[model samples]
Every structure is written in structure tokens, then in C-alpha cells.
Target: MKIVNKLKYIGLAMLTLFVSACEEGFDDINTDPNSPVEVPASTLLTNGIFNVGYTYWDRDLNFEFGELMVQHMAQNEYTEEQRYSFATSDFNFRWGNLYSGQNVAAPTGGLYDLSVARALVEENENLSDAQRANQLAVIDIYMSFGFQTITDLWGDVPYSQAFQPGEYPFPAYDAQADIYTGMISTVTNAVNSIDTSVDGFTSGDILFSGDMAAWEAFGNALLIRMGMRVGNSAAVAAGFGGTLPTSDIMLTFDANQDVANPFYQDKVISSRDDFRISAELVAAMNAQSDPRLAMYAMPAPGSTEIVGMPYGLGDGAAFTLKNSTSDIHTNIEDDPTAPAYLFSMAELEFFRAEAIVSGYITGNDATAFAAAIDHSVAQWGASSPGYGASIAYGSSNAEKLNAIALQKWIALYTNGVEAFAEWRRLDHPALTPSANMAPGVTGIPVRMLYPNTEDGTNGDNLAAVGTVDLGTPVGWDN
Candidate 1:
């Protein structure tokens, strides 16, 4: 009876082994097709491009900080920033957006995505010579733009060893000057890498849709802008160590739901009453009889005057607006489908004018200035009856500079961050400091404080940069 029981157990064990072997085959047959092993380069590019301009610049820098610092707009209720009271910061998020910040589902990571996108094309064994060159060139442009935005805002940031995930858990900060120099080289290589004979990343591209000409123009324009930013127009004149762009770099949006103007989305469609034009902006525009005024603000209550609210005036402050203070105009407030209006022919012309003034280029300042005014004025789709007569460029160096700066200020309405940077660079329009300054704060901030993320993880590295305060200028603020 014992021998019979042992034989029966052995037979059962053999049947169990057969079932386990068959289950291994079932896994291979049932592998999920819907799951993706790797993201495509095109999707990465789309996310990176939109997030940089729309997510980081348009929202965080422009909406939260830029508008007030430049004295363009202010808030009534949540006016802590306007009052010069900065808390920790959006810098970590800024870094993430550009390098590895968590973006919305599907499309995310700024420079990180671009870097991976470039690698994707470079590593692909099937792509032809032209395909590789064009794709890499576009990626280079994206990288340069991302880098400039970083150095310009933060002064010193992780770059040399950044973005190397496990390798650089705590990347060292590179000086802004060094970062700018490297960016010049990167942009140059990008321009050279573009193979006009081959196709580009057309389907994946949102800005210009793979047009190499637009890409080239964008890269070169960025180079010029960065060069000028460092007060080195001569370097920009020679193309930041290479060739300058002759063509224009411009970005205009239509009524596309996916890629509409952020301002329209926030203020008009959502109907949020968080922000309004600042007093300084209204006074300055009205002083110049600027044609772009009406397009920016509505007339004050019971008066034709388009007055704006004072900066730093928080809740219960001496102000008069019935829940709304000079809301943005119909063109912007009404059209959720409005444009981001990235750059203008006027802006390029202004750069040229400033380059000449700084002795970087040999063009006539007056001519360049006049041309800049014409382009900028026309960009607003407004008419000034006596532009050449009343608002013409001045004669003296200081006067002409002020004129250039003032006009540039007017031209840079929605583009608040760039406007703020220029204000620090040139001191144009000479904005009056708000009386509602935060306690212990001296004046309006020239550069935002370093993000607190560095304080916890990169504490030692952050210390090397020195103490961050409101009055301390950024590295390039020289």
C-alpha cells in the first residue's frame, strides 16, 4: 500500500510541472501591445518646444513675476509678489520645465525632451544623412534657446554635468558668461548642421513646421539677442563668433485650440480677475500718446482715460476699481484664439539699432531707430499721425538711448519677462518704485532669488554664488 501511494504522488508532480511550462508560453502570447517601450523623438520635440515658450516663459516668468517687476501689471488681492515679498520660488519648477520638470501627461520635459529627441534621431540606424543633419540642427536650436533662458534668469545654473540623470544627482553651477559662450558655439553648429537639401521634423514641429529657414532665423536671432544681452554687441555683430542672421525670426499664433495665446486663455476665457495693468504702464503710454494703448487697456470708469492700478497696492489699499481695473482689451481679452506674438520685425530692428548704438554694428542709428519704430508701430496695427514728427528718435546719445528704451518698452507689452530684463539692462522708462514695498525690502528686484531646491540638495553649490537679495543684480545685469 505504501509503494502504491508513492507512485500516485510522482504522477501528480509531473502534471503540475506541465502546467507551469504552459503558463510561460502564455506570457509571451499575452504581451501588452498598447504599452510603449520608448517615446518617439517627434513627440518629445513637440512637448519641449511648447513647454519652454508656453509653459515656462508665458506662465511662470511672465504671468507670476515679469509683469510686475517691469511695472507693466499688478494684482489687487494676491499681491505679495507685487509688493516685493518673494517666498521660496518657481525656479525649481523652471529648472524642471527646461531640464526635467514634470509637464502635463504625454508631452513633458523641456531641454530633456529635446536632448532625447536629438539622440533618438542620431541613434536611429535607418535615417539618411539629410534627415539626421536637419533633425540635429533643430534640436541644437531648441537647446540654445533653453540655455539662454536659464542663464539670463538664474545667472548661474547646472549645465556642464546637468541632465545626466544618475550621473549628476547634484550638478555643479556654470557661470552665466561661460554658459553664453558655449551657447554661441551650439547655435553656430546648429545652423551649420541644417541640410537644406533634406527634409526636417515637419510633422512633429509646432513652430514653423520643419521650415529650415525659420529654424535658422530663430537660432541666429537668439544668438544676437543673447550677445546683446551681455552688452557685447560686437560679438553679436559677427554672429556671436559666427555669422549673424539676415532674415527675421517671428512666431505668430492663430485660432488653434491647442496652441492659442496664454493670456487669452487665462484672463478672457477663464474669466479670472487676478491681474490688471500697472499705473506706471498707463502713465508711460499716455505720456507718449502711444498707439498701442487702446489695444492694451480699456477706458477708466466715467472717463475716457485708460488709467491702470498702482503696483504693490494689496487688498484694502486706496484704490478705485469695482472688482476690475483696466482689464486687457477686446483683441486680447476677447480672443482666446489670439497670438503669443513671440517676436516682431520691430524687435529685430531695435536690436540692430541698439547694436549700432553699442558700436557693435556700423548701421546708422537714426535710420535703424526709425525703421524699428515703423515696424513696431505697424505690428500693433495702429496709426500714430505724427510718428516721425512727434515720436522720432533723438539726437544726443543719452536721449536716443532713452528713446530706444522707451519705444522698446512700449513694443514689449505682453512679453513682460523680456521687458523686465531689458529694463534692468537699460533702465528705460525709469519706472517709479512702488510705495507699498514689502518690509525690509529696499527696491524693486532686478533678478529673482535662487530657487530653494538648491538650498536643500545643492546647498554647498548655492553658497558659492553668494547670498541672494532683492537689490543684487544677476551676473549679466552688469
Candidate 2:
């Protein structure tokens, strides 16, 4: 698979500019030399990409909420989240960072930075028409990705009215259905606007270094993913019509502490052992004699046995069995340079197979299903000749869809955010709530609750969303 190295030059360039600017303003007494009048688009682009990657891959939101809910990873210390004990405050990080946080133009994280970068690029007269369009299109694709993540978790969220603080201070929450539709429009427009002949971002393009063709492919793939998400036949067709990205869109990292892989930093650098491979995932893999299990989890300490920890248990029981259970494989958990994917070819192939099963597109489900597993296994640095044969594509469409969903679930091991949404849609593997769950947690939660911050700041809009709870289904789940 082709991957962009995410060169560290962006940081160097920013530092060089800062150092150069300091000398110019040093003689002036009135000027505040510390702050720049305007930030460059390249700087904003780099920061926006990093923020998106960091926030999505965050341990609290990704591992604790999404992974545990989908039964991929089990909590070892804080079992409350694993047991469906959720607090509205827990979601504040994702909500605040993704929308309007402290700064309107340059928030600490989320789509605000991307939007700002797009505006800067547009305003820059130095750039040619092709360069400006390509850059803006790439930014649009990224913003759509971020917004989709937001709407997927929460049913109704601030979208259309968001990012305009001066005009609409308290942005109204947009319906999940409308958000999906808006994303489709954004992604479609972005894809159409891409001019592959020209460069998008000549610098600070961490994902694909000025590769407009790659950006176009990424946009198209994103559209397909979104289409499958909302069960929109027209969207599926439109996306399939264009070129689908063959390689994975990844978030790469370096040795820099600020940009290093969060999972590695938390698990190895901090020496925290708060998570383990879940028994549910382990049993499923074990049943199929999955070769990737060796790569997914490490053997129990001292013994070459992969023992998965129980999903959600009391603190005492969990601690007692921690040593006996398997930690995640070092290649994944401890590797500082491991890339987090925005989208993978494996997932795309799975979507293709699913689209066929659902009559969204015309293709052979069996062939696409086999390709999906092959891509997944190969991507994880594993090989199993004839592995596709082990998982049968049944005669009926329903059976084929179930098989695709189950394999796709395994393929999406660490990508808990995407996995959570897929699980809600497919409902395969038949997951149940943990036995030691919080009171009133009768079943698995289909959607995340809004942050308490929303009630405090946007009280009117919050109340207008109507009564909701963890079990309430998002629009796509129907």
C-alpha cells in the first residue's frame, strides 16, 4: 500500500518563520512581537490534520467509549465505561474540539482549523486558480470527515449554523439525516472540484504530499463510505462511478512528543496497563483460527497463550486477572509510528460487498467478500493462503451481509469510532450489554448522549433536541 511519509518539514518551516518574524518586530516598541498578525494556511492545515488524528484516536473517546461499546477492547482499571456507566462530561472533549471550542478560526482541534485554512488559501492571491481549488477541495473533504464523525456518534448536532459565532452564537442542532445529506453534498462537491493535474498543498500535506489525484480518490472513497453509512442508493452509485482509492488514507506520526501515536504514548511511555484484548473478540477470532490474532494480541506473560480478559468486570476481578490476560500486540500498542487510518482499502472492499448485497450496486458479493478479507489480513502484516475460504459467503443475501459485517468488524480492530457506527448499522455478531452494567442500562447504547456543556451554553438548542438517552437510535441505525 502506498502511504505518505508525513514529512516533519512543516514544523521546521513554522519554526523558521517564527524566528525570522521575531527579528523584524524586535525594534518596534508598540507591536506585540510574540503574536503573529495572521497565521499561514500551511500552518493551519498541519495543525488541523494533527488535531483530527489526535482527537479521533483519543483513548477516552476511541478506546473507552467506542472500543468497549463494540466489545473490541476491555477496560482493566476504569470499568465504569465498559459497563455502560457514562457521564455527559466524558463527551465534552470530542464535542468541543470538533465544533467551536475556544477560538472560532483556530480551535484547539476539529473542523474549525480546517475551515480557517481553506479561507486563508482562498484569500492568498499568490496561488494559481488550480492550486486554490485543489487546496480548498481537500479541506472540504477533511471537514466532511470530521462532521461525519460528530453526527455518527450524536444523533443531532450543530452543523449548518456552526462556526459562525458572530451571527449564530448558539447554533441549532441539525438532524442526523440532514447532516448525512450535507456531508454527501460536501464530499461530492469536493470530489468534483479536484484538479488532479495541479498540487493541493505543496507543503504541510501530511496525508498525501500535494497529490491531488490521491486527494480526489480519498474524497470518492469517503463518499462511498458515507453512502453505505446512510443506506443511500444514489450516493453509493455516484461514489462507485468515480475512482475509489486503492491505498489507505492514514495519519502518520514521528518521534515528536506532540505528534506521536497517542496509544503508544499512553501504553508504553506512561507505563499504563488499563486495557486488554476482549474475550468476545478473542473467541470469535479463535473460532475461525484467525492468523491475525497473533498480531492483534500478545501472549500471556511467560506463556505463549493468548488469553483475553473479560469484557466488563468489577475492579477487583479485573485486576486479579490482568496478568493472566493478553495485552495488545506490541506492533500495534507500543509502536510510536503506527499509522491511524482515515479509510482503508479493506473497509472499501467490505463496503463494496455490502452494497452489492443491499442492491446498491452490481457486483459479485463472494468475490468482493474474499478481496475484503485478503486486504484486511495483508494490511495487518499477516498472510493466510486460502483464508477467505474459511469464512463462507452463504447462498442468501442476508447470510452474505452477516458474514461481511463480522469480518469487517475484525478488520476494524483499533478503529473503534468507525467500528461503533458499523456495529449499530449491521447488528451482526449479536453483542449484548455487560452483565455488570450500570443501573438503567438495559441494552447496548446506540448513540452517545450530548455533553453537559451543551445544556449550559446552548440550553435552548439542547432542549429542542427532544428527550434522548443512550439506547435511542441514531438516524442511520433505523
Candidate 3:
């Protein structure tokens, strides 16, 4: 997969124009009828896709928040988030970007851009019915992915009325159950709506290059993912009934400063080593002799051993352990053009295995389970001979599901948000709460708290949603 360099140019140009148009004298300067003030759907698509990919790789949200919470990575310096102590302000970026957007003069958010694109697609006069339908479906599919991330993070969130500023300024937060149902329906409909005969977006499509077939596969995979997440095996079966794409849905980055992989820039370019592999994860992999460990981390400096830092340690202790602990592998942190995955074929296989065990799909659970591991190892280009034979798929459904969940956790490396969500849903390979926890923090957080700004801006709606706390589980988690 290659990063579209044109996306960077288009995004920057649109932002400049957007900011200039907000000035008082700008509108008067542009009197030409042919000059369009409104940003086109293609430009919006580029902005939205880039933001979504960027957010997933963001240090604050995905690393410090999701990865730390799930014990995949640990803090080596300030340990507030690692110890489950964080201000509501920590979530403002993610929450705001998903619902609204940043930059008052030139806002660009995933949901916001996709919504604008949908409207523009509907209004386009040159597009044929099939082209328009496929385009709209593609937008909806991306929107569904964004919504799923939002609802999974918090128990309830603004969904039904979101993005309709004039209609519902303070959109009521929809319950997680209702949101999941809606998302599943949206993905299903989007998959059905796609017309393979025509292209979705001939330009500005960063994921699949306007391939409707890829879009359809992505939608089905998303549907299955959501269904399996909420314990709806029937939806999983429905999704598995269709053809799955051979490739993962991802966004690739380039070495350019404007579009470099965030993790790479943070660790290598900036020379910041604020995080280390967690001892918990290291111990888990060591127990199974997981071959991916070599691919996931580097040996501690001056030693051949790959040591992990103790999770949730105090600032002094964490700093002390930092040098002895391994950082992320050079292949990852040292490479600026790595790909960030939205959904992977490995994850799809895991879902299929789960659906099979649930008796909702016709397939051998063990075969799918083995294939899942093989896909994961192949995807990472790791050597793991006799790996599948080493692990056992137990007889009972509980044991089988446990095996799947544990392996899925390992396979979901670097994708902290999705990994955290699955850990909450499965509760397998039970993780211990940090012994050096923050004040008033007794257990691991099940969900993220709403951003503090929401209270000031949408206080009434915020209050109506009930208590917002780290301890409260999301709908599917319970």
C-alpha cells in the first residue's frame, strides 16, 4: 500500500482557502460566479480519511490512553494515564474530532467530512444513479467505522442527531445498544448499496483507490466485526456469508513530515522514548514463546534481552526501568512509512473462528483459529514454525472463545483502540490492576470518560446520559 501524496497537497490547499474565506474582506475579494466557496466532496474525503488514520496513530489517544489501559505499552516517564489517572480534558481531541472537528476556521473530522461528502454526492448532477449510490455508500461505510469507535469508547454518545447542527445543536447521546444496532444496519445497507460496476471516488480515496469491490468487502468486514463485538453471532454469519477481501483496509504513511507515521515521528524523529513495552505483555508472550515478540520490540540497549518495563510504575521507578526496558522494534519506530490498519484480514479470520464456535457459521473453528494465527504471523512477516501446533483449541465453547480472544489480543498489536475494546468485551487472559494506581483508582478502566468541555457546551444533554466515569462499562462490555 502506498500513501497518496496528492492527499497532502489537496488537504493543505483546502485549509488555506477555508481559513482565508473566514476573513471579513475575503468574501468581497471573491466575486466570480465560477469560483466555488464550498469545499468539494473529494477534498473533504481526503481530509476525513487522513484525520481518521492520524487519530488512530496519535500518541495521546491510542498510545497513552488505549495502549496503556490495555497494558500493551507502559509509560516510562509521567505515569498518570498508566496509573489510570487522567483528566477529562485528555479525551477532548478524540471526542471533539469525532463529533465536530478541530480548527474553528478550517474544521476537518471523519464523521463531519463524510457527512458533507454524502450531501454533496446526493446533490451532484453529473453522476449516474449507480455512481451516486456507490459514492454515498462509501461515505456511509466510513461514517459507520467512526461511529463504532465512538460508541465503543464511551457507553453512550451523540449519534442519531449528530452532524445536524441546525436541527439538533445539543444532540442527545444515544445509548450504546441502540448505536450498535444502528451501525450494524448502516454497514449492512452500505454493503448492499454498493454498485461494483462503477467507481466510488475516482480521486481523493486514500483507502482503496475508489474500488467498489474493496469498499463492499470493508463494509461486510465492519458488519461482522460489530456483530461479533456485540455478541450477535447471526450478524457475523450474515457478514461471513459474503466474500471477504484479501487485503486489509489501511492508510499508509510516507516519510514526509506532513504525512509521516505518527508513532515513527514520535519515537525516532523527535528522539522521544517516553514509552516501553509492558512487562505484562512480555510475560504473556514469553509464556507462549510467541515469535512476534521479536517483531514487536527491540532488545534493551547494550543487551541482547528484550525486557519490558513494569506497568504503571511511579515516575521515578518508571524512569529507572526505561533504559533496561525495550522500546518498540526498529522496523516499526524507525520506519516513517508504515501502514496503519483500520481492519485486517487477521482480525476477519478471528471473527470467523468465533462465529464458527458460536454455531452461527459453517466452518471448522480450529481451522479458522489456526488460519488466524497464520495470517497474523504472515502479516507481520514473522517466523513461527510449529506455532499453531503448540497451542490447543479446547473442546468447550468457553475454552475455544478464550483461546481466540487471547490470540486476537496478540494479533491486534499497535492497534490499541480495537485491542482495548476486545479486552473489555472478552475479559480473557485477565489483567491485573496496577499496584501503583492513582488516587481513588481501584481497578482498570472499562471505558473512557466524556470530555470536560462537553459539560460546559452541552451540559443538559451530558447530564441526561447519567454518570460518566472510568469504572462504568460500555453496553457490550457488560
Candidate 4:
């Protein structure tokens, strides 16, 4: 979206006035009665939406998701031989946080929640008709994308009644199936309604800069990704008649160079603080002689090889570095300014390859699959030495699929959520979990548990949805 020219004046001036007034107390207060209580739409969108998006995209949550999936994919094994413990629950809280009810704190006010989406939607209505429609379209895409991600991880979620705390003190949970269907439809409609002619969106659009075309592409790409979720289910597959054909769905990858890429700027609080390359992920890349390896990870101390540290290890063990190959020494590597990816042309190619392999689309599967790998490598900024020219695509169909998935895993270093989700679907580049890991986690967790708050506050609705253990596999897990 176009940068708001007035943001500096508003943000800085407001902060200055608020601080100055607070020091004066009630007697010196000169609050403008007619001034807007709420911040500008641009500031709100940037802080509420883009900021959160970048944080989530670059951090442990995304990495954990990818690590779990990669372990299940069999590309690597969780090695206690190494002392890397970031991915382990013992060192990082995310493992347990995700499974337990604790992580629910995010939905209450975090970016992943509906509050920002609602704010954008509500504000768009006050704009001119054309602007309103365009903004609404963008909001729909984001809202649907967010909700779909929530349902994917936690089967039953507060959807219809969610974000309306006053109206529904305890919102009912919607089934995963219903949520997916609704998300697809909502995103589709939004993509179709976008007005490409709009000059610019209100500043704060961190993903695409309010470029309607990019948003349109993103919506369609998301639809294709969602459609593949149910690809293995006969009933669901038949429902779509093997192919979910719609003008909105971009079945082929289009490399629009102008497409906005969300990355960390030279700011301390940006994406850099939240993420790191897991030893498990780095090792997988090294094994394949993957070109993206160096870009994604640094050489571990005392070794040139990129080895992965095992998950579920103790923090005390991290410094030992027995089997560890590399460590991210700076936040610059992990932060959003470090090129945190939301979506990319590479991902689009892989999706199409999957579609072709599954018979959902007509194409030369091998060609599409190989192209996917090539695109993914390029997307990862693999121009450095030691990076391989291309990922090896084995002769067999399974091998070809593995190659596609492996490259996807590499491409997903920044976008771990998608990588994790895809690994579950493809189940390739085999990974094995740590033997010392927790019980009932014999393999990777299939889905995350609903936040415990839902059970207490929205007990009846949660009860209706029934409880599924965090270990339960979903539609994507074969």
C-alpha cells in the first residue's frame, strides 16, 4: 500500500503530546475534544497486521512447525548428539506452549487473531465506495487466511462468533471442515472483487503495499493450498471433481517481480528477534548439498558442515555443541528484515506440481515438479558458493515428489508454517523424532491443542466440538 505521508506527523506528534500532557496532570491537560481517539487506519494496520505478520512469519513458532514436519518427513533425525535445543521444548517454551492451553493468549490480542482484521474491515466501510470495496476485498483475503490457519492447527475454533466478544461472551466453535469451506469461499469472493485500478491502499499494508493484484494473487494461491488439504479424502476430492477450477485460482506460478516481499528493515524490534534456523532444518539442507543451506544457516562452531542440533535437549547442553553444525549468531538472520517470506512464486510452482502429481491438473508432472525445485532454490537467494546448482530430482515418482518437498522445505525457512503444513501433506525427505522426547509424541504432533481458555470460558461450545489430543493427525497427514 502507498506509504501514508502523514503518519510521521500523526505518530510522532501524538506520542509527544501524550507524554507532555501526562507530565502536566489534570490541571494542565488540554485534550482536544474533537480529536480522534483511535489512531489512523495506516498506523493501526501496520502495527496490528503487518507487524504481527512479520513476527509470526520469522520466529520459533514457524520454525517449530517446520521442524516438526521435517522430522516427520524423515529428512533428518532429532540428534541428542548435538546440543542445539532451540527446537526442543526443554530450551524453548513453544513446544509445550503450542500443545498446552497457554498459547491461547495470542488470539486474545495478537496479530493472528481477528481484532486487526475487524479493525481494517470496520474502517474500510467509512471510505469512499471504491476504496471501501477494495479495502473490504483485502480484508476478506487476510481474514480468511488467518482463520484458515487457526482451524488447520486447531480443528474446532471460534469462527462465526469469534471477534464479537460483546455479542457472544462465549463464542461457539466451528468444525474444521466448515471453517475450511468458508475460508475458501471468502477468499475467492474477495479476489474476484478486487479493483486493480485503485491508486494505493492506506499505508500499513506490509505484505503487498495495498497492491490489489498481489492481494488477488495471494488469495488465489491460498485457495489452491487449501484445496490440496483435502486432496487425499475421496469424498472431498469428489466434491471438487478432482479439479477446483476457478478464474481466481492461479494454478501456475507467475513471477511478478513487483510483488511486495515482507522483510526486516534495520529496526531492532523487527522480525530478527523472533526466529532462528534449527539444527534439524540446517542438517537436512546440508545432507542434500542444497544451495539454500548457507543462506538459511551459518556453519556450526568447530565444523564447516551444517549439522542440526537435536530437539528436546537442555539449555545447559547448548554450549557443548557436540554434534551441532551451525548457530545463528545474530538476530539479523532471524528477524523479519532478514526477508521473512509470506508467500512466493516458488510456493505456487510446488502447489501446481502437487496438483499435477495428484491428477488434479493436466501437465507433465516431471517438468512441473522439476521447475518447482528450481524456482524454490532461486527464491531462497541461493547465489553463494557451496550452494548446489539444483536439488536432485530422483527418477521415481516418489523421489520426484520428495525432491519437490525437500526444496519446499528449504524455501520455507522464512515461511515455516507453510513448510510444516506441506511436509505433513507430502511426507517426504524422511525425518525421525528424538528418542528422548516426550511420551505420546512417538512421531511429530499432527495438530495443536485448542487453548485451555476456550474450555473454561466457552466450555459448552468446546465440549460440543469435542477434545482432540494435540497428537491427533489431520487431513494433511497421510
Who is ahead in TM-score, 1 or 2? 2
lDDT of 4 by residue, 1-478 (tens): 3322222323222221001001111012222334333545455444334323433442344544544445411112333322222222232233222211122222111222224333444545457766766675665666555555555665666665554334454666666666666666666566666777874366656666777777766766667777877553332233233223222221111112111222223113233322235666656666776776665556656777655655544434543544354544343342422444455666766777667776776667666656656666665556544233344667776776777787776666546567667777777657665555454455556666554544545668768976566456664463
> What residue pairs are clashing in model 2?
none
Residue-level lDDT of model 3, residues 229-345, one tens digit each, is 898876787788875779777788877755678788787777888888898899988988888899989999999878998887889999988888999888878888888889988
Better of 1 and 3 by lDDT: 3
Give per-residue CA lDDT, model 2, range 242-351, as digits (tens).
97787878888666544567788778777888899999999999998998999999999989989999888878889898988999889977778888888998899999
Weakest ten-residue segment in model 3 by summed lDDT: 17-26
Candidate lDDT scores, in order, read: 0.65, 0.76, 0.76, 0.49
Q: Model 1 over residues 1-478: C-alpha lDDT tens digits?
A: 0001112122111111000001111111111133222767776776567656665445567766777788788786667777888755656665555555343321344565565566577777878888887887787777677666666677877666554434455556777777777677667677777776678885778777888877777777776787788876644775534443443344444354334566766665556666777777888878777787887877765677776877778666724453446766767656755555555667777888888787887878787787777676776678874473467677778888898898888788777777888888888877777778888889888877776766887778778887878778878886
Best-matching candidate per TM-score: 3
For model 4, the run of ten residues with the poorest summed lDDT: 17-26
C-alpha-based local distance difference test score of model 2: 0.76
| Ordering by TM-score | 3, 2, 1, 4
For model 4, the stretches where C-alpha displacement exceeds 4 angstroms are 1-40, 58-60, 64-128, 232-283, 311-319, 322-324, 329-336, 384-390, 394-397, 475-478
How many collisions per candidate?
1, 0, 0, 26
TM-score (all chains, Cα) for each model: 0.85, 0.90, 0.91, 0.70
> lDDT for model 3, on a 0 to 1 scale?
0.76
For candidate 2, the clash count comes to: 0
Q: What is the lDDT of residue 329 in candidate 2?
A: 88
Cα RMSD to the true fold for all candidates: 13.4, 7.3, 5.9, 10.4
